[model samples]
Target: MSSRDTMLARIRTALANGPAPQPPQPDWAAPVHLPLPDAELAVTFAASFRRIGGEFFYCETLAQLGAELRAWLAERLPDDQQFYVWEPTLQALLAEAGVPFQATEAEFKAQAAIGLTSCEALVARTGSIVVAPATASGRRLSIYPDQHVVLARPSQVVAEIGDALRAVQSRYGTELPSMMSLTTGPSRTADIEKTLVLGAHGPRRLTLFLLEDDA
Candidate 1:
């Protein structure tokens, strides 16, 4: 009918048989790690996580993992609490484990203050999460959510920070993504009166799951 309407129709027709549009790229780095003593890597990862702004828990198998997650969530979130889940594998696992979850990219930014997921490795040198935000959804889920749960396999645990950085440069190339967050722990600040506060701008509870297979 109108010029605008005609243009819209033409565009739709042009793209009707074309591939779907790809989502915008989100900011993400490979995966980062925190430094801990060789003998105390496990305990340090669990306790000092909050110090660096993270939370920690453990699980040997997927079933155990589910139980631990449920317990941690039950303690923090209320009965009516609604959370967003990222990763298809994670979603499937949750479903298989009978864990109630909602998978919505939009919801990730709506009610989530932090996102919980696993990483390729944890640099014992620098506490960081190597995120790959090639799409906006990955970035949104981690940052938007208030509390983030990270699952780190023992094998992925590195010894130094340089190794982590090098890993990123290699994984994504020299040109880093738009966003690469190196989260050592929960977000905190002591600028005001030098008094530390958790969840100041990010997740207050930073939980970690250092999974060990041989150990």
Candidate 2:
């Protein structure tokens, strides 16, 4: 045989003399898990999230969430700049906190500075915020804004991505949303010149507000 043909024949001979059976993948049906309290999960999630350049706030109650959120906005956003929110509960909270926001689609493109949304879960392992179509107010609110703030309850905190998936499944039954996004920190890209760039396709800042009391 020629050199190429000899090489091919050798490869075929090796394959024919290979191991009898292939190794099986680990069983995912029984995933490794331990029951964790929300307090512990919150601490782990906060550290993981902060490591990725995300801002985190823990509130003991919804009233605390409102006050802290209002203060946070006042410190960062100017009076003239627009803040947008679509979730009805969040809207009510903002109003009660005396925080100004535009809910309707009035000059959204020109005025969307910060967008606040509710989340599906807070994943502790990856410090990720899970946002699904069913949980979000609108797709644009999460992706189009300069700053994105996610409001989550302590009950929604999960230890891992799989846990988050299971929670979503339980929440929605068989009819799942079209997409579920795991947002870890801000949107970033290193494609252009191998230099890290933040907010390449989405919000520059990702802030998480975890309400520890009363979902």
Candidate 3:
């Protein structure tokens, strides 16, 4: 076998008995604050989510947020009962808003779940949402769940991919995590007979809660 093939063989052999490689340690630090255009931020996130076969909502108060969330979940959730998903921060927020909720990390990996969290940055140019794995938004919370609801503050939206990349590099250094998904929309693929299908390997539904603070 060629050198490249030999290396591949060795890698496969090593993996045959070893556990899956753990995701790298993300360099968790704050990004250099750069003020972006306000109207542009709203427009970017709204457009990005829509393009990905998703929906977006804006809520000024926790009450509005909870109401909107319950309404949205009502449609997508199974059966006639309210959805029971796991999100510590989200659960707290829901409770504060007097919305019935519960918490359990054990259920995070279930195929029925919908993950939620506030984001680090929303890149307008690529329509990508950048998330750090170390926060309440655990790596699994974002990837393992079937639906994802991201809460992105207007100030967190960046103008371009380079800016977001620089932000990640500056914070996480060279060895980033096992995954830093630049999720633009619902997971999709057209690999089978050029037929597009959502939720191919990720969330089939993506929703964004864009929060803007009127100063």
Candidate 4:
């Protein structure tokens, strides 16, 4: 027999005689939990967000949120420009206010200047907003538009990324979303000549409206 064939036959005999190799067991540990007080979390998150050039606003109720949104739209955007929104209640409110918006993915990508969507969780530790594609806020809505407006309730804020992930796991159980995005602020890059530039890849502006629970 050829040397190559002899080597192959010896390997096959060894394999037949030896026991099968077992896969290694993972030494998995539970995630660490580091909880922060709510008041502290709000303050830290606001400071961090602003440091990264993100705008933050607080609203006590849905009515206040609507009013603030209307005022913001009137001041920042042209009346003729349409925004993208997926939340049904917010869409209704905008419609009532005569603000233009596109709900479909194609229309939003094609014509919308601003994208408004609800976030899955707000990470207070890093002042990041976590969004899942499986949720109302799809991948395109958060990244396509020039501006991004996020609506988040106070209860949705968590201490850190781990906490936010745990919240997702707890809510969804075994069936989790396919993808999750953690956006810290407006897209920026300092790679070009060490000078900071905004809107490097995604939205140039990020505005977060934090809804506070009624007392």
Candidate 5:
């Protein structure tokens, strides 16, 4: 037989065997989720967050947060690094706290050493911080800067990823943001020679300000 006919006969034999068996479908109804805890979600979150090389600081009140923020800035700045805050609420808080931040957009674009922003919700199970375009920070404040400081309240802490999504729904209803991101920790990669490197893609240092309920 000709090579062409031989190939065609092989294809017909394969087709006569019927279609291939399909792989099993994943269970999409309800995926495995961590149980909501009766213990303090903040504590659970802090532990999980810190385990991945993130810095966690619990502040009892707004005043304490302001003071600690000031102290942190004082220690970190003065090295000719530019600090800026853009979000309206964050700007107001920084102003009220007497914390210095560059408001000029040009300077921020030129060299933004540190960026301060707030988050939507803090995930306790995976130590993930949920963020969306709903906030004034948008995406740049959390991604572009080398150092990111997240100022979050106790009420924003949730037990799981699903809980965070539910909180977002309750806050925004059907008009949800275009995107949602769960930041478990500072950006890191072990792709090169299996040598771990932090800040390879984004912020090298991630500091969280977990404010108390009253704050």
Candidate 6:
């Protein structure tokens, strides 16, 4: 037999003598977990997020959140700049506070400078925000705007990505959302000359308003 044929025969014999390989397990079957304390999680997430140019805010109550929102808008946005909010509860809260925001998709697309929405979970391990299509206002609201603001409660924060996934599964059960997004910091890229550029494909800024319970 030729040398190549001899080598092939030896490989075949080795394979025949060895045990069959098992199929890989599904993600849900063998999920990984890493938990953290709530206080440590918030601190770690804030530090990691800020390192990538993300802004963070903490509010003790809805009233404080509204006040902060108004102050931020006044300082950062022009009077004519349009803002969009998707969540109904948030919409009501802002409307009650007399914050001008667009509710219709048409108006939002026409003059949207900032888009505010709620997230499914906040991952403390990677400093990421998990947004599912069904829970959020719309897919485009998070991607098309110049800036994205997330309204999250302290209870929504999880230790890691796996824990976040578990939370989604537990919340939605079999009727999961069509899509889920894990966003970390602002959209940026360092593809050209190794110089970092923000807003390469999506929102240039990411701000998180984390609501805490009254003490």
Q: Give the TM-score comparing model 3 with the true structure, all chains together.
A: 0.70
Deviation of model 2 at 215, angstroms: 6.9
Looking at model 4, report the run of 10 residues with the lowest lDDT sum.
Answer: 26-35
Q: Alpha carbon lDDT of residue 114, candidate 3?
A: 71
What C-alpha lDDT values do all the predictions have?
A: 0.65, 0.86, 0.71, 0.82, 0.85, 0.84
C-alpha lDDT (0 to 100) for residue 67 of candidate 5:
92
Per residue, candidate 5 scores C-alpha lDDT tens digits across 69-181 of 88998877657777777788878877887778876566666688788888889998989999887777778888888888998888898888888999998999999999988
Comparison by TM-score, 1 against 6, better one: 6
Tens-digit lDDT track of model 4 for 130-162: 988876666878888889998777888878888
- Counting only residues 3 or more apart in sequence or on different chains, how many pairs clash (N, Cα, C under 3 Å) in candidate 2? 0
Mind sharing the TM-score for model 2? 0.81
- Provide the lDDT at 54 for model 2: 97
True lDDT of residue 110, candidate 6:
63
Which one wins by lDDT: 1 or 4?
A: 4
Question: Which stretches of candidate 6 lie above 4 Å from their native place?
Answer: 1-35, 213-215
Off by over 4 Å in 1: 1-53, 106-110, 135-137, 212-215
Looking at candidate 6, what is the lDDT of residue 12? Answer: 97
Give the lowest summed-lDDT range of ten residues in model 5: 30-39
Estimate the TM-score of every prediction.
0.68, 0.81, 0.70, 0.75, 0.81, 0.79
Quick one: ranking by TM-score, best first? 5, 2, 6, 4, 3, 1
Query: lDDT by residue for model 1 over 8-42, one digit each (tens)?
Result: 99899989879878998965764444434587555
TM-score of 1: 0.68
lDDT tens digits by residue: candidate 2, 47-115: 999999999998887678778888899887766678888989888877876777888878888888899
Q: Kindly report which residue pairs in candidate 2 clash with one another.
A: none
